[model samples]
Target: MILEQAILNIKPEESIVFEKAFAEAQKIISSMPGFVNLDLLKCIEETDKYLLLVKWESIEDHTIGFRQSEKYNEWKQLLHHFYDPFPVVEHYETVISI
Candidate 1:
């Protein structure tokens, strides 16, 4: 599996709206091919920060499958605006799991 991670820095005072938008947008992502699951977590120390973790069957499932699809436009409209400077997303493969 491939792990997608991002530290979302939301614009000041926009957390609530962002959360609602993300809740709506996640439905789009969940319907994509190769999507496994997702987790969105709020940072305890940073009120406007969120951590997004998504599992996919492969990196192409995200980079090409999702990003290249028309659904991405809807997803972007919903959640992209709330980002401060925009989040940097990265992918990883498991090194170890016990």
Candidate 2:
């Protein structure tokens, strides 16, 4: 499995609006190929920050497959504007498990 992580820094006072938009965006991502699941976490100390953990079957599933699909355009339209300075996305593979 591939783990995609993004730390989203939303503008202050726009958290609720971003959450609603993100819900819609999540629906789009869920329908894509190789998509496993997603977890949205909010920082208690930094209310404007959020962490998105997305699981995919492979990196290509996200980079080449989903990003090239029309659904991604819609997803971008829905949630991209909410970011203050755009989040940096990174991927990881499980090295150890217990």
- For each candidate, the alpha-carbon lDDT, in order, equals 0.97, 0.95
How does model 2 fare in lDDT? 0.95
Best by TM-score: 1
Candidate 2 deviation (Cα RMSD): 0.6
Per-residue lDDT of 73 in model 1: 98
TM-scores of the candidates in the order shown: 0.98, 0.97
The TM-score of predicted model 1 comes to 0.98
Most accurate candidate by lDDT: 1
Worst 10 residues of 1 by lDDT: 78-87
RMSD of each: 0.5, 0.6
Error of 2 at 47 (Å): 0.7
- Give candidate 2 misplaced runs (Cα > 4 Å): none
Question: Per-residue lDDT of 1-98 in model 2, one digit per residue for the tens?
Answer: 99999999998799999999998889999999999999999999999999999999999999988999999999999988889889999999999999
Instruction: Provide the clash count, candidate 1.
Output: 0
